[model samples]
Target: MDPLSEVLSLLKLRSYVSGGFDAAGDWAIRFGPHEGIKFHAVVAGSCWLSVEGELPVQVNAGECFLLSRGLPFSIASDLSLDPIHVSQVLPPNPSGRILSYNGGGDYLSIGGHFTLAEGQADLLLQVLPPLLHVRDQLGSATLRWCVERMRQELAEGQPGDFIVAQQLATIVLVQALRFYLSGRKAENPGWLFALADKRLCAAMAAMHATPGERWTLQTLARVAGMSRTAFAVTFKGTVGLSPIAYLTHWRMMQAADHLVSSRCSLAEIGSAVGYDSEKSFGAAFKRVMRCSPREYGRRQGGKGGPMLRSGPTSSSTHTGG
Candidate 1:
């Protein structure tokens, strides 16, 4: 798998809550600080989305936005209006339904949140902006189709609708990320943006494809078709980390995943990630993750299961409607 796919696969999404609300006349709803990424697409009409500590953004029909940091936010027909808490408008326990306010009609939106496995959210969050907004021109028709289908699944309440809606919501999140990557100019120094540079991406892909390979600056530079000095300077400038630093980080991440989800022995896990000894692996894990492998696994309950599961509220964001 590619680097992006590898990272996402390791995240282990647990649950998500998919739903939306409709309102007519002047109205605003305040959602409290959230734990995971929240996404919403304007199915009809428009509103102002005000995230705490940021300027209010106007979202029009056929547009969508993602809230990455789990900040408190408000959606309103007019920002001047007093916002009602979302709990007041939505049932105490949301059931993935289309909620209505003031009899419904004028404004409509559909979306949800994705919750990742314990202690794994930062892998994606560290590389994301606070908010991502995707306009119609930048978004694909497939995203629009997913939004419409999600709306139908939530509103109609057909058998198996929940499963279908959840899958579609996941698709929306992926597509939004794709558009963001495609439209980005690589002006920023981040692993996500580094993919925009073909040379950097080729080197990154090699590391991701074989974290167990003992990679050196020269080997990676050769993979990128550049001299060692040039590759080191460029990689640090663009990816914000030396090539070996990134390799070690990626190896620890892979080790952590295995530690949490497998019954592998410490030596086995260490050897798989290119560490010949448990001592080296433990030191590296502590350095990158701020904890030892055993401790991290204990914190996560050390259960083995499939990487991705269906559920509610987590982290990440997207842009578009």
Candidate 2:
């Protein structure tokens, strides 16, 4: 798999469109900052999206905005309007219906959150721009199609709608990432930069393709067609972690997957992820995932699967480069 696909697979993003809003004249809703990403798409009429530090951006019909870093922001008919909290505007009505917001003019939009379903979200999505604005429906047919599908599914539920909606949401997120990266000038250096490097891409592909392989520093450097020292320094500089560190993260991720998905013993899962013994694998998994393997598996299997604990709310924003 390609580097982007590889990373996304590890992330296991699960998304859903919820709480549709139909507003009219003088309306605004403030979304509090939280972990994960949020997206809004205008179906009819226009609205303004304003985050802290960035100028208010007008999103017309057929346009969409993605806040990748969960920065606090507000959407309104006008920037000067005092915003109502999203919770108040769209109360906890579990009926899954399009909510009507009547003030004066006619407007309609849909918004939702994209959550990392598994793996390490902070590390996997760290390279993404904080804010992504994609305009022009005609140019982005795939994105438009995904949004429309989601809208249709949300408005008129059917059998298997939940799974289909999730698949479409994934497509929307992937398209957003592609659209954001397409216009990137490569001014920032990180995984995006490293993915574009031919040698580094080769090395990453090898590591991802076969995490169970007995890979040494020398072996990985040879795969990248570089000397040991040069590859070590270059990999660390480009990826922000040593090659072995990255490998350990990947291995732990794989082990976590096995623990939740299969009934394999600890020893079996460890060996599958290149660990020689369960003790070594448990040590590394705890260091990376912040919990022991058994506890992680129990949490995953029990009621209410793992969720990122909410942190302090803030409006500080980071714009897309």
Candidate 3:
């Protein structure tokens, strides 16, 4: 699998709620702080979206935005209007329905909230900005189609509509990330942004494809068709980590995934990720994950059995509406 696909798979997206709302003139809704990622597409008309800690954004027809940080936000036809909490307008349970407000019909939008596995979301979220706004001019055709399809699926409520909406929401999430990568420059120092550089992509792909391979700067540079010095400079500049550091981080991430998903012994997992000794693996895992492998597995309630009382784990939970 490619690096993006591999990382997403390891993150393990759990559930999603797909729904929308229609509103008329002079209205606003304040959505409280949420968990996971939230995405919205303006289907018709427009509104002002104000996410805490960020400037208010004007979302016009056919435009989409993603909230990666799960912050409090509000949407309004007019920002000055006194906004009501979302619970007052939408149902408590996400039923994939298009709700109406103030008699409806002036503005329309559809959205989806993705709830990823606790403790794994930061793998993706850390590389993303808090708010990603995809304009109509920023190659949003596929995203537009996905949003429209999701709107229809929610509105029509046909058989299998739930599954269809869920799939489309996933597609929207991926496409949004793709568009963000394509439209921006590689100035940002994150692995997600590094994919925009062809050379960095080659080296990263090699690391992801066979993480167990004992790789060095020279070998990875050769894979990227660059000298070792140039490769190191470029990799650090774009990915914000040295080549070996990134490799170790990726290995630990793979090991973490295995710890929760597989019944492999610690030695086997360590060897699979290029560590010859379980002690070395444990140390590396602790350095990167802030917890030992065994502790992590227990905290995650994986095959490692019941949770033992320990210091706080790095995992997080997102409860989306």
Q: Number of the top candidate by TM-score?
A: 3
Q: What's the C-alpha lDDT at position 14 in model 3?
A: 52
Candidate order by decreasing TM-score: 3, 1, 2
Model 2 TM-score?
0.78
lDDT of model number 2: 0.75
Candidate 1's TM-score: 0.89
Candidate-wise lDDT, in order: 0.80, 0.75, 0.81
Tens digits of per-residue lDDT, candidate 3, 148-178, equal 8888888887998878888888887888888
Q: Can you give the lDDT of residue 216 in candidate 1?
A: 86
| Superposed Cα deviation of residue 24, candidate 2 (Å) | 3.3
Q: Positional deviation of 277 in candidate 2, in angstroms?
A: 2.5
Per-candidate count of clashing residue pairs (backbone under 3 Å)? 17, 1, 0
The segments of candidate 1 whose C-alpha lies over 4 angstroms from its true place after superposition are 185-188, 302-321
lDDT of 2 by residue, 224-246 (tens): 99999999999888887788788
After the best TM-score superposition of candidate 3, give how far the Cα of residue 10 lies from its true spot, in angstroms.
Answer: 1.0
Error of 1 at 11 (Å): 0.7
TM-score of each model, in listed order = 0.89, 0.78, 0.91
